[model samples]
Target: MGEVTAVAQALPPWVLVVIAAAVGVKYLGQALAEGSEQWARILGPLGRRWRSRAERRTEKEAADLVALQRQVENLSVEVERLTARDKKRGEFEEKLREYLVYDANWHFRAQLAAAGAGTTLPDHMSFAQWEASRP
Candidate 1:
Protein backbone atom coordinates (compact mmCIF):
# COMPACT_ATOMS: atom_id res chain seq x y z
CA MET A 1 0.00 0.00 0.00
CA GLY A 2 2.85 2.42 0.75
CA GLU A 3 4.67 1.70 -2.51
CA VAL A 4 1.51 2.19 -4.58
CA THR A 5 0.74 5.45 -2.86
CA ALA A 6 4.32 6.73 -3.42
CA VAL A 7 4.26 5.85 -7.10
CA ALA A 8 0.92 7.53 -7.63
CA GLN A 9 2.09 10.67 -5.95
CA ALA A 10 5.37 10.77 -7.97
CA LEU A 11 3.44 10.71 -11.33
CA PRO A 12 2.32 14.29 -12.13
CA PRO A 13 -1.18 14.70 -13.64
CA TRP A 14 0.05 16.97 -16.44
CA VAL A 15 2.76 14.48 -17.52
CA LEU A 16 0.27 11.61 -17.69
CA VAL A 17 -2.14 13.70 -19.79
CA VAL A 18 0.68 14.64 -22.20
CA ILE A 19 1.77 10.97 -22.59
CA ALA A 20 -1.77 9.82 -23.27
CA ALA A 21 -2.33 12.53 -25.86
CA ALA A 22 0.95 11.69 -27.63
CA VAL A 23 0.05 7.98 -27.78
CA GLY A 24 -3.41 8.75 -29.14
CA VAL A 25 -2.06 11.09 -31.78
CA LYS A 26 0.58 8.55 -32.90
CA TYR A 27 -2.00 5.77 -33.28
CA LEU A 28 -4.39 8.02 -35.17
CA GLY A 29 -1.66 9.08 -37.60
CA GLN A 30 -0.62 5.43 -38.15
CA ALA A 31 -4.27 4.43 -38.84
CA LEU A 32 -4.81 7.28 -41.33
CA ALA A 33 -1.62 6.42 -43.25
CA GLU A 34 -2.52 2.73 -43.42
CA GLY A 35 -6.06 3.53 -44.62
CA SER A 36 -4.75 5.84 -47.38
CA GLU A 37 -2.33 3.14 -48.61
CA GLN A 38 -5.13 0.55 -48.67
CA TRP A 39 -7.44 2.84 -50.60
CA ALA A 40 -4.77 3.47 -53.23
CA ARG A 41 -4.17 -0.25 -53.54
CA ILE A 42 -7.88 -0.94 -54.10
CA LEU A 43 -8.38 1.80 -56.68
CA GLY A 44 -5.17 1.43 -58.72
CA PRO A 45 -6.46 -1.35 -60.97
CA LEU A 46 -9.76 0.38 -61.56
CA GLY A 47 -8.02 3.56 -62.70
CA ARG A 48 -5.77 1.59 -65.07
CA ARG A 49 -8.74 -0.33 -66.50
CA TRP A 50 -10.70 2.86 -67.14
CA ARG A 51 -7.76 4.40 -68.99
CA SER A 52 -7.39 1.28 -71.14
CA ARG A 53 -11.03 1.32 -72.10
CA ALA A 54 -10.83 4.96 -73.03
CA GLU A 55 -7.81 4.31 -75.24
CA ARG A 56 -9.69 1.51 -77.02
CA ARG A 57 -12.68 3.73 -77.61
CA THR A 58 -10.49 6.44 -79.05
CA GLU A 59 -8.79 3.99 -81.37
CA LYS A 60 -12.13 2.67 -82.58
CA GLU A 61 -13.32 6.17 -83.31
CA ALA A 62 -10.18 6.92 -85.26
CA ALA A 63 -10.61 3.75 -87.32
CA ASP A 64 -14.20 4.63 -88.04
CA LEU A 65 -13.24 8.08 -89.18
CA VAL A 66 -10.62 6.64 -91.50
CA ALA A 67 -13.15 4.22 -92.97
CA LEU A 68 -15.64 6.99 -93.51
CA GLN A 69 -13.05 9.07 -95.29
CA ARG A 70 -12.18 6.17 -97.55
CA GLN A 71 -15.83 5.65 -98.37
CA VAL A 72 -16.26 9.29 -99.20
CA GLU A 73 -13.27 9.17 -101.53
CA ASN A 74 -14.65 6.07 -103.24
CA LEU A 75 -18.02 7.74 -103.69
CA SER A 76 -16.38 10.81 -105.15
CA VAL A 77 -14.51 8.69 -107.68
CA GLU A 78 -17.72 6.89 -108.62
CA VAL A 79 -19.47 10.17 -109.15
CA GLU A 80 -16.66 11.39 -111.38
CA ARG A 81 -16.78 8.21 -113.45
CA LEU A 82 -20.52 8.49 -113.85
CA THR A 83 -20.29 12.10 -114.89
CA ALA A 84 -17.68 11.22 -117.55
CA ARG A 85 -19.80 8.33 -118.84
CA ASP A 86 -22.85 10.55 -119.09
CA LYS A 87 -20.90 13.18 -121.01
CA LYS A 88 -19.57 10.55 -123.43
CA ARG A 89 -23.07 9.09 -123.91
CA GLY A 90 -24.44 12.55 -124.70
CA GLU A 91 -21.75 13.11 -127.31
CA PHE A 92 -22.41 9.73 -128.91
CA GLU A 93 -26.13 10.46 -129.11
CA GLU A 94 -25.52 13.77 -130.82
CA LYS A 95 -23.26 12.11 -133.42
CA LEU A 96 -25.87 9.37 -133.99
CA ARG A 97 -28.50 12.01 -134.71
CA GLU A 98 -26.28 13.70 -137.28
CA TYR A 99 -25.58 10.32 -138.98
CA LEU A 100 -29.28 9.51 -139.14
CA VAL A 101 -30.11 12.88 -140.72
CA TYR A 102 -27.36 12.46 -143.32
CA ASP A 103 -28.54 8.95 -144.21
CA ALA A 104 -32.10 10.18 -144.73
CA ASN A 105 -30.92 12.98 -146.97
CA TRP A 106 -28.82 10.56 -149.07
CA HIS A 107 -31.80 8.22 -149.56
CA PHE A 108 -34.07 11.09 -150.61
CA ARG A 109 -31.55 12.29 -153.18
CA ALA A 110 -31.19 8.78 -154.60
CA GLN A 111 -34.96 8.39 -154.96
CA LEU A 112 -35.21 11.75 -156.71
CA ALA A 113 -32.56 10.71 -159.23
CA ALA A 114 -34.36 7.42 -159.87
CA ALA A 115 -37.64 9.22 -160.48
CA GLY A 116 -36.02 11.72 -162.84
CA ALA A 117 -34.39 8.90 -164.88
CA GLY A 118 -37.64 6.87 -165.20
CA THR A 119 -39.93 9.74 -166.22
CA THR A 120 -39.87 12.44 -168.90
CA LEU A 121 -41.26 15.01 -166.40
CA PRO A 122 -39.03 17.96 -165.57
CA ASP A 123 -36.84 17.54 -162.52
CA HIS A 124 -38.29 20.80 -161.15
CA MET A 125 -41.66 19.31 -160.11
CA SER A 126 -43.02 20.42 -156.75
CA PHE A 127 -43.14 18.06 -153.75
CA ALA A 128 -46.96 17.79 -154.04
CA GLN A 129 -46.80 16.66 -157.74
CA TRP A 130 -44.13 14.11 -156.93
CA GLU A 131 -46.30 12.65 -154.16
CA ALA A 132 -49.35 12.57 -156.46
CA SER A 133 -47.43 10.70 -159.16
CA ARG A 134 -46.21 8.03 -156.79
CA PRO A 135 -47.76 4.62 -157.50
Candidate 2:
Protein backbone atom coordinates (compact mmCIF):
# COMPACT_ATOMS: atom_id res chain seq x y z
CA MET A 1 0.00 0.00 0.00
CA GLY A 2 2.84 2.40 0.88
CA GLU A 3 4.58 1.57 -2.41
CA VAL A 4 1.36 2.23 -4.33
CA THR A 5 0.82 5.53 -2.51
CA ALA A 6 4.48 6.50 -3.20
CA VAL A 7 3.98 5.80 -6.91
CA ALA A 8 0.62 7.64 -6.93
CA GLN A 9 2.22 10.64 -5.18
CA ALA A 10 5.07 10.61 -7.72
CA LEU A 11 2.45 11.30 -10.45
CA PRO A 12 0.40 14.49 -10.71
CA PRO A 13 -2.78 14.31 -8.55
CA TRP A 14 -5.03 15.83 -11.28
CA VAL A 15 -4.18 13.04 -13.73
CA LEU A 16 -5.32 10.27 -11.33
CA VAL A 17 -8.48 12.26 -10.42
CA VAL A 18 -9.34 12.83 -14.06
CA ILE A 19 -8.86 9.11 -14.86
CA ALA A 20 -11.21 8.16 -11.97
CA ALA A 21 -13.82 10.68 -13.07
CA ALA A 22 -13.67 9.40 -16.64
CA VAL A 23 -14.19 5.79 -15.54
CA GLY A 24 -17.17 6.75 -13.37
CA VAL A 25 -18.64 8.80 -16.19
CA LYS A 26 -18.24 5.89 -18.58
CA TYR A 27 -20.06 3.42 -16.27
CA LEU A 28 -22.79 5.53 -14.50
CA GLY A 29 -23.31 8.72 -16.53
CA GLN A 30 -25.50 7.11 -19.19
CA ALA A 31 -27.80 5.52 -16.56
CA LEU A 32 -28.18 8.88 -14.71
CA ALA A 33 -28.98 10.74 -17.96
CA GLU A 34 -31.54 8.11 -19.03
CA GLY A 35 -33.24 8.22 -15.59
CA SER A 36 -33.56 12.02 -15.77
CA GLU A 37 -35.05 11.87 -19.24
CA GLN A 38 -37.60 9.22 -18.24
CA TRP A 39 -38.58 11.24 -15.17
CA ALA A 40 -39.20 14.34 -17.31
CA ARG A 41 -41.26 12.42 -19.88
CA ILE A 42 -43.42 10.31 -17.52
CA LEU A 43 -43.98 12.45 -14.42
CA GLY A 44 -43.98 16.08 -15.54
CA PRO A 45 -47.49 16.35 -17.08
CA LEU A 46 -49.04 13.81 -14.69
CA GLY A 47 -47.84 15.81 -11.67
CA ARG A 48 -49.42 19.02 -13.02
CA ARG A 49 -52.76 17.35 -13.67
CA TRP A 50 -52.80 15.77 -10.21
CA ARG A 51 -52.05 19.10 -8.50
CA SER A 52 -54.82 20.93 -10.39
CA ARG A 53 -57.39 18.28 -9.55
CA ALA A 54 -56.41 18.36 -5.88
CA GLU A 55 -56.87 22.12 -5.71
CA ARG A 56 -60.33 21.90 -7.30
CA ARG A 57 -61.39 19.16 -4.91
CA THR A 58 -60.32 21.24 -1.92
CA GLU A 59 -62.30 24.22 -3.25
CA LYS A 60 -65.43 22.11 -3.64
CA GLU A 61 -65.09 20.75 -0.12
CA ALA A 62 -64.79 24.28 1.27
CA ALA A 63 -67.96 25.33 -0.55
CA ASP A 64 -69.86 22.30 0.75
CA LEU A 65 -68.78 23.06 4.32
CA VAL A 66 -70.02 26.63 4.04
CA ALA A 67 -73.41 25.45 2.77
CA LEU A 68 -73.69 22.88 5.53
CA GLN A 69 -72.90 25.50 8.15
CA ARG A 70 -75.74 27.66 6.84
CA GLN A 71 -78.14 24.75 6.92
CA VAL A 72 -77.20 23.91 10.50
CA GLU A 73 -77.79 27.48 11.63
CA ASN A 74 -81.21 27.54 9.98
CA LEU A 75 -82.18 24.23 11.54
CA SER A 76 -81.07 25.41 14.97
CA VAL A 77 -83.30 28.46 14.70
CA GLU A 78 -86.27 26.36 13.64
CA VAL A 79 -85.78 23.95 16.51
CA GLU A 80 -85.69 26.81 19.00
CA ARG A 81 -88.92 28.24 17.60
CA LEU A 82 -90.70 24.90 17.74
CA THR A 83 -89.49 24.32 21.29
CA ALA A 84 -90.96 27.64 22.38
CA ARG A 85 -94.30 26.73 20.84
CA ASP A 86 -94.26 23.34 22.57
CA LYS A 87 -93.55 25.03 25.90
CA LYS A 88 -96.56 27.33 25.47
CA ARG A 89 -98.84 24.39 24.60
CA GLY A 90 -97.57 22.44 27.59
CA GLU A 91 -98.47 25.34 29.93
CA PHE A 92 -101.99 25.50 28.50
CA GLU A 93 -102.44 21.77 28.92
CA GLU A 94 -101.36 21.99 32.58
CA LYS A 95 -103.90 24.72 33.21
CA LEU A 96 -106.62 22.62 31.58
CA ARG A 97 -105.79 19.65 33.80
CA GLU A 98 -105.97 21.83 36.94
CA TYR A 99 -109.38 23.20 35.92
CA LEU A 100 -110.75 19.70 35.21
CA VAL A 101 -109.68 18.45 38.65
CA TYR A 102 -111.43 21.35 40.39
CA ASP A 103 -114.58 20.93 38.29
CA ALA A 104 -114.81 17.17 38.98
CA ASN A 105 -114.50 17.76 42.72
CA TRP A 106 -117.33 20.30 42.69
CA HIS A 107 -119.57 18.04 40.61
CA PHE A 108 -119.13 15.13 43.05
CA ARG A 109 -120.06 17.37 46.05
CA ALA A 110 -123.21 18.55 44.28
CA GLN A 111 -124.32 14.98 43.63
CA LEU A 112 -123.75 14.06 47.27
CA ALA A 113 -125.92 17.00 48.41
CA ALA A 114 -128.75 16.11 46.01
CA ALA A 115 -128.77 12.50 47.20
CA GLY A 116 -129.02 13.61 50.83
CA ALA A 117 -131.82 16.09 50.27
CA GLY A 118 -134.07 14.20 47.81
CA THR A 119 -134.49 10.80 49.42
CA THR A 120 -135.08 8.88 52.69
CA LEU A 121 -132.44 6.28 53.36
CA PRO A 122 -133.15 3.16 55.44
CA ASP A 123 -132.01 2.40 59.04
CA HIS A 124 -131.73 6.11 60.04
CA MET A 125 -128.55 6.32 57.87
CA SER A 126 -127.80 7.16 54.26
CA PHE A 127 -127.06 4.55 51.50
CA ALA A 128 -123.47 5.64 51.66
CA GLN A 129 -123.30 4.78 55.38
CA TRP A 130 -124.79 1.36 54.77
CA GLU A 131 -122.34 0.71 51.91
CA ALA A 132 -119.46 1.95 54.00
CA SER A 133 -120.41 -0.30 56.94
CA ARG A 134 -120.50 -3.35 54.65
CA PRO A 135 -117.09 -2.72 53.05
| TM-score for each model | 0.52, 0.49
- Report the lDDT tens digits of candidate 2 across residue range 13-114: 899999999888644544343345553344456444544555577799999999999999999999999999999999999998898688667666777786
lDDT of 1 by residue, 85-109 (tens): 9999999999988996896687678
Clashing pairs in 2: none
RMSD of each: 22.1, 16.9
Cα error of candidate 2 at position 42, Å:
14
The worst-scoring run of ten residues by lDDT in candidate 2 lies at 119-128
lDDT of each: 0.73, 0.72
Kindly give the number of clashing pairs for every candidate: 0, 0
**Candidate 1 local distance difference test against the native:** 0.73
